[model samples]
Target: MTSQVRGGQLARLLGQWHALPGRRRSPDYAALAAAVRGLLADGRLPLGVRLPAERELAEALRISRTTVTAAYRALRESGHLTSRRGAGSWTMLPGGHRVASSGLWTPQDDLDMIDLGIAALAAPPELVPATRAATEDLPRYLGSAGYHPTGIIELREAIARSYAERGLPTSPEQIMVTNGTQHALDLVLRLALAPAGSVLVESPTYPNALAALAARRARIATHGLALDAGWDADLLLASIRQSRPRLAYLIPDFQNPTGHLMPVDLRERVVGAAHAAGTDLVVDESFVDLPLDGTPVPPPTATFDRHSRVITIGGMSKPYWGGLRIGWVRASAPQVQRLAAARIGVDMSSPVLDQLVAVHLLADAATIVAARRTQLAHQRDALLAALAERLPQWRVTVPRGGVTLWAELDGPVSSALARAAEEVGVRLAPGPRFGLDGTLERFLRLPFTLPAADLVDAVHRIAAVRYDLDRAGRPQWREPSVIA
Candidate 1:
């Protein structure tokens, strides 16, 4: 059973509930109860997760105790919640059903859900031919024991060569392939951080990376990256000096969600600061190759690491295809060896076929990058245009690269808006999902990975829900946070 949620967690969840639509026609208590039921139906509030006390939730939401009591009573009557004299209310599916935690995007059996949660692109046209070509070479590995813990030597050399061309001299010995960047990040965190060790991460960073670090019980220290200003080198330097974290993880190039790239000079300074503070840097270059603009790609962070303090993680998932599931860590040879050894307990090696396909794809990197740049640029523009025409209240920045747009909603009801959008067949990742605690309620990440027509239609659905919320006389809650 999931542990009981209380205080801030429950407050955050309830805040999302309060943002639902149809409040104009329904009683406050009934509206609140229906919001809670919607969350339960969508698996956002998992079955068996205990809720906050009625009074506590009321205070958090700044609503009356009677209102919350009535809402809880309604939920209990509907069989969506259960309460006892002492035990706080617990969420339940109707008929005592249970649902598993499916993270942020749970696919509904319904065919029309437009997924804007995952920031990834489908396989490029090159993937099919590349995989077929890889088959001819597969026979060579068939005679071997078939388990190469680090990676097959050929693929490693190709990756190293790619790095060298980008101004970072890397040996094949410096590379260790993993299932994806997430796995590579996990291995590095395990190798570098002790339990409860401090880790400096970018505020509004990739949610999955935050989840992985939390799982390791690391104490996360944050430095916010302004969408306009990008990384504040001095602030980041100060954070590293003050916190003295064991590691610092950053996505300097076309950062996830925000799409801000750290300048080359800032990159050098950050590496130097981390080195002086004795913190290793884990830089994610997953979106580095997906630049929509024609600017030359920034060199790898390792290029600035005079002390070998940077562990660079790159993957084929974002630029080429997520299904390939091929990623690598470019670190010191010793660190690479350590990570490979640590992988012994996990799956011994990535699939040979996937690695082979990745090698073929990497060989065609320039063409693949160009194709993605053109495609994403078109989709990004379409999304921006749609949002401007349909939801003028939303403020969105034009990302230089990457697949997602970090959009600021007009109010602090992203969770509520997402829930409302779901009823209209649109899936969204609310802002709070990206941040620790209950912050970022006013933000949402919108991906342009879908076709232009679907992108337009998704925006229309979201606008419809926003219209409903507006009609319900929901107070427009605004925040001062601004992103360029």
Candidate 2:
């Protein structure tokens, strides 16, 4: 018989539970087996709880029942389960896998898993043609000793024109090419941030950015954008005033994991806020082109950067492909020189070939954007529709642009849900991985960059995994798993 957890019975047992960790010859056996034991020790699963039948789990896994029996036998021998004849295997854990009811995003099989972690669509077919065209012009630049630190004028001019079309008045003198968006951002940070100086960023913001600042030991102050609706102006201004940070980083168009787009008015206020606070503003528009809506997108944050303080970091990765490795910073002429110097030790220059590909793609951006806009819209819609129909227990808000659907799962099992999805062929990133500390443990960021068919299959697999966990008494499954 099952019994509810009462008193410190759980906390006390939880403190004493122990599960040995070891690598298994079987990838599937390793993570799950260890997890089962760990969960028992942690008191996440009370004694006498029914374990999902071995046959059912094995069927879902496409594995033999013998293997499942072996796994269960091992757990039982280790004091995890009390398997009596016909009584079925029941959780009688004091020691076992450190599986928690809330870990949906742990490792499953290192093989047979398709990772949908960062939101990036495969490159468009046209990218190859652009690379060839850029290669043809490479020979001419080679005559100049290939030491152009200010970067090839062709790519710089192209990026400047892109800004101009985006409603930002820009000139070639205001652009600098870098290895990628991160590189450009790092260079800008190197130039702008002082040791212990503060930076204003969104809580649950990009962790890489946090790591970058941490590398410099810079103090970061954050404002909340949890509404998933984008930036909150009043709180943002307060952060600006209170922290008086040296730099402010924003993804205003579709802020990373939160998927919130900072409205036009908020953008204006933030720019003014930074200017008044004597702060430098840096905006990343990496996924600006990936909205599900097929239409022209907005310009970079530099549109209101009259003081030349805002540095806009952009890349061809999202629009073109992740392998492109091409990004640039739009800043004043003086700032461009500053970045060139900062990057001398990093890499004398980005590969001449890669820059060529970016140049050619920049030439045909309009057509490329149109095709990408259509494809992403379809993929995103299909994923959202599937989630709505199959996993209504979750909440997912439709993003205007950007490749992810930031959904909040009902329970605290986002991490658990991720772990379960792995066993079922769907690899996912835990919400916490995208946030600072444990800020978003209940949220899930789903990527819709795959083709419509794959997105459909992925959502379906995710649903089946969720259903199995619920049936197995892992009912901490987020209710309304698609919480918007």
Candidate 3:
């Protein structure tokens, strides 16, 4: 039996539909078709989800039935939807494959598909040696029960020492190990937020963090981050003072997608403002160690916490390797204990082997940081040059750190471009996926974590798809503009 999505549910899921900005030259039906195809391509409309009937959806959306029928017909011709007699159309991938809705890439995924969706890095060269050393030390723990709810003591102390060295003065009792930064954020949100409680986050922040907050059913308040100016401190402070949310999440160092670092003074002010408003601050430092420009990084946001109101989440995922799956949350001793207790229902503890590997890797933190900095600098430069050569119309900033570049297109067609790019074998994370509302459709986050050759080839493939879109007079493409 097929699962049916009702007219109301489908409309709500689609959110506010806007035509591609700057593409008024295209027909409305074609634009609507592209939007629906984007939803399927990004796994937002899961495979086999029966769409609402054309007439029903058109009435719900207040659009003409002819427009809806034309859009549905286009989708069917493009192989993104299938319809049976007396039945509604259903979503499907090209070639009649039913893709899982998780949107995660597995080892079994199509090997030829170039993935720019995930900003994860591969294992650093030091990981193998570290893993071997961890295996040698594993025998001592074989005699004891391996359930370390607060993480193995050695790993906790190592993480705490890392913070202290960075000027945070953390103690082992104040740290709890987690599977990853995402897991750490989930645990903190579970402990700090209640149903219908208010939360504050930066607009265009990490998508997974937003997902975690949504799962808790918390009301979210957003403060916008300007692409060129970095964080709008005055607006953020005002929001905190006015809303007084239960928690505020900020990525102060080398922020995801945007790659802009929050200045030290602004960081202090934000922390102070949150505390004055009686709000707990959750600072995500996952990208803190990946500075590509050799700038001196600022102290962790916890440095300004005079009232123990700041909780910092860190991980080895970006700087070290995604496969390590080791991260930690640093807070007050009492708060750490509460979080560890709350996390028991979710996950008893992170893997001991991974924690041991993290301990070894942390021992040589400086060396690893130096190596990553050098490698990423080269890749970042290569990607910038490639984009300039191929897609000069797209504006991008050279981020001082972080793995991705947030490129702004001249038109609001990121979702459509991503869908089309997939047909040409490149998968991109559309900018709207990173935002709460259906904004940022003009932006695209491209990771520079791949090798220089792969980065170059990916851009070439993307440019080819973009050219095709332009040739078809698709609204997503625009004439190249002179770079100021």
Tens digit per residue, CA lDDT, model 3, 1-484: 7678777766765664554433476576787776676566554565688999988988888889998899889888877789997967898656524332124222234557778888877788888999999999899898988899889999999888888888989889999999999999999998989887899998788988988987787899988888887788788899999999999999989898799999889989988898899999999999998887678799888898889989999898999998788888999999999998899889889888889999999999999878888988998899999999999999998899999899998777777677667666677888877786557878999998888888999999988877776555442311122333
Model 3, runs deviating above 4 Å: 1-34, 43-56, 63-109, 473-484
Residue 251 error for model 1, in Å?
0.6
Q: Comparing candidate 2 with candidate 3, which one achieves the higher lDDT?
A: 3
Return the TM-score for each candidate structure.
Answer: 0.86, 0.75, 0.86
> What would the TM-score be for candidate 2 when compared with the true structure?
0.75
For model 2, how does the per-residue alpha-carbon lDDT over 1-484 read when each residue is reduced to its tens digit? Answer: 4644332333332231122222333344444555565454323444577676777656655567776688778677656667778757777643322333223323222455556665787889898888778888888877776766767888888888877776787888888888888888888888888878788888667656776886677887777776445666788888887778899888876777766777676677777888888999999988776655543455566777678778889888788888988888888889888888888877788887788888888888889988988888888889989999998978877888777788878776665567667666676776765555345657787877888888888888888877776445321211111212
Top lDDT model: 3
Off by over 4 Å in 1: 6-107, 473-484
Superior candidate under lDDT, 1 versus 2: 1
Residue-level error in angstroms, candidate 3, position 470: 2.2
RMSD vs true structure, all candidates: 6.0, 12.2, 6.0
TM-score, cand. 1: 0.86
